[model samples]
Target: MGVIGLLMRPSELMALVKLKKQIGVWKRRSAAQEKDADWEFCFDMLNKVSRSFAIVIEQLGDELRNAICVFYLVLRGLDTVEDDMAIDNATKARLLLSFHDMIEEEGWDLHYGYKDEKVLLEEFDRVVRAYRSLKPQYRATIKDITRRMAEGMQKFTEMEVTKIADYDLYCHYVAGLVGIGLSQLFSGSGLEDQGIAQDEALSNHMGLFLQKTNIIRDFLEDHEDYNEETDTRRVFWPKQIWGKYTDKLENFTFGKNQEQAVACLNHMVTDALRHLPYSIEYLSNISDEQNFLFCAIPQVMAAHTLALCYANPDVFKGKIRKNLGECRNTHPVKIRKGLSAKLMLETTDMQATLSILEDAIDSLADKISPTDPSARETIEKVQLCRDLIVQGRRSSSPSSKVASTWRQETSKATSYVAEQCTVPLLVLLFGITAAVDVPQALGSAWWQSEAVPAKLGPVHVWLTSLALAFYSLTLLLLTRGAALSWCKALSAAQVAMTAAEVVFSPVVGLSVVVQALPKLLLAAMLPSCAKQRHSRQLFAKQQAAMGNRRVLRPRPIKADKSY
Candidate 1:
């Protein structure tokens, strides 16, 4: 994480909490449905192979969720074949060419991929079963993309990525195809319109941008994978771009070639930046809010990653940026725990997601918190007590994101309780007082009496009851999150009833004011606008997004059913 990335303030922390809650709600909803072994195994494989993707996939509406999940697994299964260096050239090419057909085949499992990826390969049949269960449109989308991606993978497996066009073409085959497939899946769900998938070039740009970022950051890993001994592994950094700086692509990672490497890195980042406007335009077309988040979360993260990657020499060293491997792989430059949550929470419309992009662009442009050359992040200390403070205590821990989130949520809950109780408490006090005063009007005591209406007149009887009931309803509704309009109208009714109490039957003026003061206070103090305008709009959208978001519980193959 960078300097600014460390401090996750209260709002960002809360966003993370809310995101977890939203995901949990989806999970619980999924759990409540009829799931069989095949469905269970598919989800297990999904969460196993893809980390961030599984979470995002689970949040989609029911119809498309299963299909998207299957789509991802199929691609992961294909990627495994592509990544496994142990597989000889011919057999791997055959597997890559036929991956789409394998998704439909019964009892099809392979054993040649890497560690965790091998799990996906071994039980590939379960994913095939789940894939088969999807709607025909979804199946067609997955198969079509898979077939194309497989052909691309097969072609690239033999050919080295030699030029910029080839790099873009390879990404299109792998990651760009994933983007197109997702857009098609979104359309199939009926959550988004067919128009969303209509612009194929725009969607492809989204994938290219992300895929290029991955290739840039993973330069070390991919370059290391570049072997003269093995013809199978091809380094994705196109020679055409890197060739401008050095004779060899791997030389970019060497300290002696630092300047050339940075120049090359900047070149790659600049290439990726070309697609930002296209990505922004793509997100602008997505109308469904959940689908927007599903797409935008990673898009925003990509921008943040680009901000970190641009002109930074760390990616060439490999440790700061973990490339595609296990599901746990994350770039240190990432938004971290609260980052995804904040983007998901704060990004209401496309405008907000663009604002994040704008911030990243600013960082790249040196507009915000420009990096200082003299500032060293880590210094070798010569002595312990050289600073101004004589006795500095144990280092003050930066506020924990989890702890800060917990405290903020607790404080909100406490404040919510206090807010809910305040008006209602006053209203209840006034209602009780007014109810007590009805018979007190008959007697001497008003503020002094504990009696109900015993000998009051018909007019006073109705007045007291009206006043009491209005107060009760106002308070009751307020605490229950009812519209303030209800309380506003009831306040008007209470005022009229109290005025009649004073007009006909109230013998004491002092008691009437005392008894009616709370409602009058409430009426005067009630907000003209209920909640803050933005908050109301944002939370309303969040409720719609989170509220019973249907995750398709495609039944587990309960019996020993096979294709």
Candidate 2:
């Protein structure tokens, strides 16, 4: 990964952890109140959802988890600022500034919102205390998350503009940075490069994906409670894309623009899905278990969002959550044996990007450390470390696009070898009864002549021909299998890309190329030549052009399930 790419991703992970912890503390604090049962339940569900993230941190050691936790705990203060409508703007500004001051001074005042301030405050205090108990590094990360939150809030309150751009920025302030943080953490794990640097673009897309999904899902409530007259409504749907569907989207308030919103929603999902495969490489590289939590939760959440988009409209009416019960019921158990791992290693493309994230989390089970900090400053340092790592990596190599191309090419080559193999085999079978048994004829070709060679008898020649035919037939069967595998794999990739219309424009006439034509050709071709490496290469070039290389981004694109 490039310097900023690594740094950007790490920031994403850190931001995500902070968000989750803040939510966790809020949920815990709110659950104590008798009147807020429903709220508590929602928070609890969210917390349950958060546990899936535990997989990321599972291997990173306690310092990383504490670092993340502390950051979120402190940032929860700022979230309280935005979430609590009762708080006046002036006080919110003061509190946010105070947080900024705490970062500079190395200490913070925790008494401002202690009593009747809300569950978040109490939860924040607890996390802060827990953070203070950790090592300095962890404490620093906590402080950093808080500081960033403070800075973000400062920007939010001081802003004179409220454009759709502002909402996008706000989402970034709130969530996009998390995407950046995670990318760093992922790089730290040191996986074989799957274009991690170029992943910055993908990372940004991922952040937008998650945030946009949130915005779409929360459109009704935000409009009801948080809408500002000065600001335009719902920046989640960009003007360019919305122009095509606005007429159809008019009345779709609570799941109103269900169809169109899903189209837009999928733009982000597919973006996430595109990068999601790298999580496997990341997990394989990491030695710590705690890191898994950071990886798994977001993946599960992303998957849940995708499911919601594809599901009923009720998902938009309220939070569509994947709770512990639901998650457990559906969760896949990783096949941990060497044989299974070996098999998995051979089929990286087949593994769902979602599984990559979960697997990263799953891999963290054996590596938890207890000394980690869950504070803001430490999280910030972690962010800085990530930034440093990305920078360092970038110093070694400059072009993300070129690197991505190499990785894609490598993937294609490996897939080709795994999918295709040429084996010679017989195409015909017949019994020949020699009229002149054991005759020695010199005129015609020995096998066809029903004659024995001068040195060997006719019987020996017949036996040799039979053996050659058997070998050829065996080779033919193997070749047929290999050719069939290559054809299927190639088509599958195309089908998947086409399905992801959210990420790429669909080729108007490529369906036949990826579908009917290849299969037809495979069936009609001579078995011996069908699996020829040259033929496979020629076909693969076309598949890569159609499936991997970018074409123009589709206008008003919608995701399909072509796969």
**How far does residue 502 in candidate 2 sit from its true spot (Å)?**
47
Q: Can you write out model 2's per-residue Cα lDDT over 356-473, one digit (the tens) per residue?
A: 3333322221111122221122223223323332333333334643554465567556545433422211222112212221232223344442222344444445443543453344
Best by lDDT: 1
Clashing pairs in 1: 36-556
lDDT of 1 by residue, 439-533 (tens): 56455444443333335666676666666666566556655555443544554555556556667753566766775666555544433222222
Candidate lDDT scores, in order, read 0.65, 0.40
User: Where is model 2 more than 4 Å wrong at Cα?
Assistant: 1-60, 100-117, 157-168, 179-209, 226-244, 247-250, 255-289, 310-563
